[model samples]
Target: MKDGWIVNRAGLINFWYYDDEVFEFMDGRLLIRGANGSGKSVTMQSFIPLLLDGNKSPERLDPFGSRARKLEDYLLGEEALSQTNERTGYIYMEFKKQNTKNYLTIGMGLRARRGQPMDSWGFTLLDGRRVG
Candidate 1:
């Protein structure tokens, strides 16, 4: 979604270690609330492998953001899924940078399949005059 952070969905893995469920993300943030061992930590751990090599740390406890896992699960589809949930929707994120009093928008809308690899896609920049 962005350079330093990402926003996406929550992925679910079946008892067999296969991803079987995905919670569609409407907003970029999620508040995981459930009893202990209800998959909150596991959901967070799923994002670790996506960070830059050194960005990952063994001491880190929870990766509670939507980006990595959602992207991973989408890009790595069926291969990552024992069963896919077609009802799932796309997870979208936009990276922002603060400049003085304004915020500048950077990357946007990175999509991935339930169990496939992250998609390599880019956006087109529009000219200011005629495109309105």
Candidate 2:
């Protein structure tokens, strides 16, 4: 039998929420139900850049190149920024590849500065205590 690929955990900080919130996925389908502007799309689309190879910009993420115009476009707002927090925003996902014996975690962080053209961002991958 082929191994199962499941999203073990996922979360974001400052992208949609001022604080961090994590989601643990069990063995089943995930259904995100919510009202308008409930951050449903924000939570689902948060993984696109982490799972796939990209510059983590809105235009790159948009295949049609018609949706987002800049990286700051995804930033929740100036209110989401904080002097206490080192990172302006970030998204992370942890999962096990099919049939694989190892667990992988990937994440991306954003830093936006006022009046700057673009936000400074970086990506990370972690397996156990090792980092890449």
Candidate 3:
């Protein structure tokens, strides 16, 4: 069996946020603070549980447990906010082994283009393969 991994950090690129954002975990827990419409939920949900299992079903993407929202909404936004019809984004989690420099990295690469279905891929880097 492979070594156990503990989450160290997660982040987003070009999804919801125009700028890259990183969420660092303290003992596998995260506490975030921000005003309404600030994108806190989208930031966390993009990684947690999703990274753990690589399931991006609508049920898992929405924190409210509603099937109304879609991951595409985060990548390309609504008709008004989107600057381009096509775009690519990423969500990643960095994991570290207990008391060691070893790591395991997992993530998803997502692309959305108008008049087309979303294209995506999932990956894992193990045996001390860090995100660096």
Candidate 4:
């Protein structure tokens, strides 16, 4: 970790929709410019999942009581699971560690049953590689 070890980009694959979306941090800021109901809040929420510690009380994460109880819940949606294929969705984040020579990629794969919690999600951390 370094001073410039910050999130530079993010991607979501079939987490909410069947398509994939990617975003890049520009000018050292992430600006979600969109109209209402355009997933601004959801996109913003996606950035915090990796930093969350589920073992701790979720009071800070769910202070509003109606936001989200878990990180997967934030990513889960009505059609989060794929109906046409066996592939589950995933969320990816890229961080520029220290300098430009090395980077860190953190990924969270999500899978859920119709009436069950999304406890099947997987988290992975890769060093010195970039995954997109």
TM-score of every model?
0.30, 0.65, 0.84, 0.67
> Per-residue error at 64 for model 3, in Å?
1.6
Candidate 1: tens digits of C-alpha lDDT, residues 52-119: 12222223423454333333333244444435433222221222222212222222223445534434
Candidate 1: segments with Cα more than 4 A from true spot: 1-6, 10-18, 48-132
Candidate order by lDDT, decreasing, is: 3, 2, 4, 1
- In angstroms, give how far residue 106 of model 1 lies from its true place: 16
Of 2 and 3, the candidate ahead on lDDT is 3
Which 10-residue window of candidate 4 scores lowest in summed lDDT?
A: 51-60
For model 2 the TM-score comes to 0.65
lDDT of 3 by residue, 1-132 (tens): 235567788878888765587878876667999998787776677887677777778889887888886778778887677677888988889888766677778888899987688999998877666554
> What's the lDDT for candidate 2?
0.60
Please report, in order, the local distance difference test score of every candidate based on alpha carbons.
Answer: 0.36, 0.60, 0.79, 0.58
Task: Locate the minimum summed-lDDT window of 10 residues in model 2.
Answer: 78-87
Please write out the lDDT profile of model 2 over residues 8-61, one tens digit for every residue: 677677664536777776652467789987877666666665345645656555
**By the TM-score metric, which is better: model 2 or model 3?**
3
Provide the lDDT at 10 for model 3. Answer: 84
lDDT measured at residue 74 in model 1 versus the true structure, 0 to 100? 35
